[model samples]
Target: MSVTGPAKPNFAASGRRVFDIEIEALRAVVARIDGDFSRACTLLLATRGRVVCVGMGKSGHVARKIAATFASTGTPAFFVHPGEAAHGDLGMITDADTVLALSNSGETDELLMLLPVLARQGNVLVAMTGRPDSTLAREAAVHLDVSVPAEACPLDLAPTSSTTAALAMGDALAVALLEARGFTAEDFARSHPAGSLGRRLLLHIRDVMHGGDSVPTVPADATLGEALVEMSRKRLGMTAVVDGERHLLGLFTDGDLRRTLDDDGIDVRATPIATLMTKTPRTISEDALAIEAAQLMEAHKINALVVVDGKRRVVGALNIHDLLRARVV
Candidate 1:
């Protein structure tokens, strides 16, 4: 008798099938948007207090993420677990707040338990669910139909397609409110002070560059040896060549020195920096963003930059390391 191995599972096909189901579910729900969506946006836009999101199980996870997105995008919001709300966490909700509830079946006991209290308090109740006729949906002031044709799971038992629709709908609400409130990138950065966008917009060259007495600068008539001393003392890997009135004349970097040495060029003690410096070196204003400085360095294929003032006077100097430390790199 010949032994045969069990047939292999088609993992890729399984994934493709799941994707197809979710895509179809999304398409079906896209056609369900009606006046309810507009009503939800109006309630969110008119909310003077924070948005209170509550749900149970997987819907609670989605609700938490939605709350975070709303908070970061200029709307004040927080998540409250419906199970905990049956205890003391319900104190977190008030009539001044708007309640956003999520439930795939629209009959999650823990979530529905709060409907009566919310109704009595006269708080706006917004529900995202698959069953429009369910208790939670019927009690909602604004019901968003996040119903899907079928769950991505073969058994139709998972929250896959339904959760995706809820997440997307939450994003739609956040963005609509964001645009209506005229939220700008700068304002967005304020909420994300520790993130890359915050660093890019809030940090100026002056904040990162070496300024005042620490600036690496050598007079145009200074010998190469003197420029080397300044570069070493300041440790910026380069020195600015400036004129008598403090105007930037040129810049000399380690790269320039190495190239000159490769060519068997001038004596370090005898040659004036004016003869060896790169005239009209790339410069940035102290007021310019550190991100802009990084862009300039990357575009020119150079590492260091001289920070200048209104009249092209050397105000400071910085290199790639400075940007790295500032997290602008």
Candidate 2:
């Protein structure tokens, strides 16, 4: 007799069960944070050099993310592969640096082989592992136990829950260090000079605003035709109306041109710009952040803003297109 045997387990149901198990494991790891966690933070903070994080396999990926988080949040850190370390990369670890090692079983052969050399070099070792009693944890100055009761894999062989626990522990350590150091968003931006937050915080109006000859401007008494020509020439779609001292009086935009055109019997060349310009147009200081300028443009529902000096004199001009090119939009 041919028998199909037991039906296959529901894959979706199994996935949900695994997720729930990992969640519970993470909660348990979080609950276990106490004096040891504090001690690890203190040790890392006291170090003068970078925090060198090392791991193998899946733990290596988590270590890299942890290093990035620490680096961005005021702590200097980088990842070094354990396998590479044993093969002449060990020179990267200086006596001044602190080493954060990860191994799910707390007994990775590659990592274990380097412990004595690292210890001999007088480097502070902080081990993150599932077994507190393992060789790596016992040899370290501070041990963070990230044990998980079970793996998310149905066969219990994959590094799922254990890896999650390690990642969460790494984040907890980074955040604790961040708070202890009083790191700010501006500090984060300084570390990530290529990111959007960096652009928002570091880019000032002077850096992106069109200035001097590129700025579209016309004297307050100029005819509407002159202002329209200036706007068209500069391609900013707006022109600043300024006095002899360059102090802004009003602004004439395409919107104003449209309104003027709609008015009965209007002559573009004969009309003065001041009579059709929008008085008290939205303006920003030249030293203000680009993000702030973007916010002003967004709130006012306008595409451009006049950059002015402390005396309300127009010095520069900016539009949404400038912001977009600068990645501040």
Evaluate all candidate structures by whole-model CA lDDT and list the values in order: 0.92, 0.93
Best by TM-score: 2
Model 2, span 61-168: residue lDDT tens:
999999998988888999999899999999998999999999988889999999889989999999999999999999999999999888888788889999999999
Candidate 1, poorest ten consecutive residues by summed lDDT: 259-268
Question: What's the true lDDT of residue 225 in model 2?
Answer: 89
lDDT of 2: 0.93
Clashes of each: 0, 0
**lDDT score, candidate 1:** 0.92
lDDT of 1 by residue, 1-329 (tens): 99999999999999999999889988988787678898999999999889999889899999999999999999999999999999989889888999999999999999888888888888999999989999998998889999988889888887899998898889989999999999999899899989999999989998999999999998978999999999999999999998887799999999998987876657889988899899989999999999999999999999999999999999999999999999998
- What TM-score do all the candidates reach, one by one? 0.93, 0.95
